[model samples]
Target: MKNDEGEESRVLLENYRVLLKKALDYLWERIKVERREVKKGKRVITKVKVTLSKKEEVYKSLRDELEEVNVLASHYVDKAISDAYSVLRSWRRRAEKGKASLRKPKLKRVYVRVKSTLRKVEGESVRITVRPYEYITFSWSHTWFSPRVKGLELGEPVIKEDKVHLPFRHRLPWFTPLDYLAIDSNLYTLDAYDGEKFVTFSLRELYSLKFGMELKRGRIKSFASKHGRKGGKLMEKYSHRERNRVRDYVHKFVNKLLEMYPVTTFAIKKLNKQEMFQDADDKLSKRISRTVWRSIHRVLKYKAPLYGSLVKEVNPHLTSKSCPRCGRVSRKAGLSGVRGVGSPWTGN
Candidate 1:
């Protein structure tokens, strides 16, 4: 009896996801078609206001179709419209910046964004709205998440692969530290200096792994060009593995750093990657792209707060060339030999 109930609940939840995704795709398709039409007609519409007037039209159109899927909620249809508009605006901005090559936005996967209000906790099971009068309730094991979810505002949930993932936020107490740890993030490793001690973490292994994967992918692509479909599948499999491996390593490295230091405040240099690499060689640019610097920064920013730590970014001007003792700037001062310099440790 329990197994049958579980199977039925899973089917209902999947149906709900499909309905939501359909609505989102429908709204997105309409918006993309209209945008292309406007561009082709040489209409000069302010990018910011592009979606504002079309929001109601898109919502109404999606609402009419969603009503046919009786189990799909009305509020979710509105949510889908809002989500599609957000994506469209992002694409428009990208196009203006010359970064977008495609004229139309496409939905390549099945996913839906569920508003937090539509999810209600009821004792052992959570009730998620499918429609105005219909709901699908499923038992959830919040053993580890119970404490974290308490007294926090939940953001929009993402439903994918038969699972609902919720994001929570809460006000945390501000952290203050008597001393600061300055971190110099380099291409190969992270060098950190706290008032009294200096430490470095080797990132060479990670770089090696990335380069190895890149070489493998290159060979795979070359093989795929000759062998066709099966080779293409193998290429995708390896690509996903590479990403997962890099992401996993970065997370583990950052977690260990936070655990080891337990510092109240951390500082890092602000790097303008685009301007720095604009005139660089393609090989150098590819190397930099393979390095997951942005991901490292993002993980540190969010994970530091959980440990009552704060992260700060300072201008990196003259960090490597400036002398610590005499307060002099030299073009020949290399970062390799210069150590125990107290100037970089000084307040900004």
Candidate 2:
């Protein structure tokens, strides 16, 4: 992320200290006016900077500085950190890992979430280009920032085009805009409400892998009953491959979702997978939701805003229980509220 000349990171960090200081100062002044406590040095905003070809020199130093920050932080910061000091503690742990203790942190460009205003458009699209201290660009084709946060002064971008509509929000621009998306994640599919409806798409590949893994585990468990002390290492190999396959599948699947729906929101149900597998009240229901919440949420958090979109975890209390046709409340007539329904709260 940084040149052999790591000073760039030092410079960028110096800049971070300055910008972060300003953010703290901004917060403190507001708190003082409101009679609140002043806390400094609490957060770092991750941004991907885009510099036009002509302004390359103007952005060069800044780019180098940012790379230096990446180099210095590669080992210390694993993407999210509230305080730079915490980086020291993590680095110390890395030091214990040996000479290669400092893993080179990849350079992260500032991110801009773009959304379009045209309803005819189905989703957002982002195009990005990167060069060392020269040019970096991320472009979007659809509209998606929160209307709630629009018109507020977030940190202003160094460059903006009026024809390219960028949503306005608070100064917390570094916070991935996807933090505000509405995700409708399911085992069978990944649907979105990007302030508009979209054709539901299939995500059963993940399901098939996970299901196969579970079946393999079950088979191994049964095998252990017959060969407990005899085949310990044999089963571990099979389990390891299945687990890796699951991880790879998750990575590829989520990456596709991010690329396809750059400004899309996520709507997911908070499923208790532990309760799902551990208890058998409704085995199918629990298994259906078990892997969804954590896996999808984990990947999408960074992945979504890395492009631009928000994610909202909805209650799955009556998703399948109530009638979609009538919007009537029902608990017994072949329908069950055990799953969950749309929040009476989101409307507010």
Give me the candidate number with maximum lDDT: 1
Error of 1 at 286 (Å): 3.9
- Give lDDT tens digits, candidate 1, residues 1-348: 022244444554566556556765775455432232234245644332233336665566667776677455566556655666676678777665457754565655545566777878665456677656666555444456766567675555555554566666776777585566777776677877776666787788888999999999999999999999999899999999998999999999999999987755888777756755664688777777667777888899999877778889877777666543455676564555533221232223
Query: Residue 5 error for model 2, in Å?
Result: 21
Q: Model 1 RMSD to the real structure?
A: 7.8
- All predictions: root-mean-square deviation over Cα? 7.8, 16.4
Report, for every candidate in turn, its global Cα lDDT versus the true structure: 0.66, 0.44
Which candidate number maximizes TM-score? 1
Q: What stretches of model 1 exceed 4 Å from their correct place?
A: 1-85, 101-112, 129-134, 141-156, 160-163, 167-179, 195-198, 269-274, 312-347
* CA error at residue 291 for candidate 1, angstroms: 1.4
In model 1, state the lDDT of residue 348. 31
Task: List, residue by residue over 79-184, the lDDT tens digit for candidate 2.
Answer: 1222322333344344433322333222233222221211112133222111133222333422245444444533222222222333334333454443233444
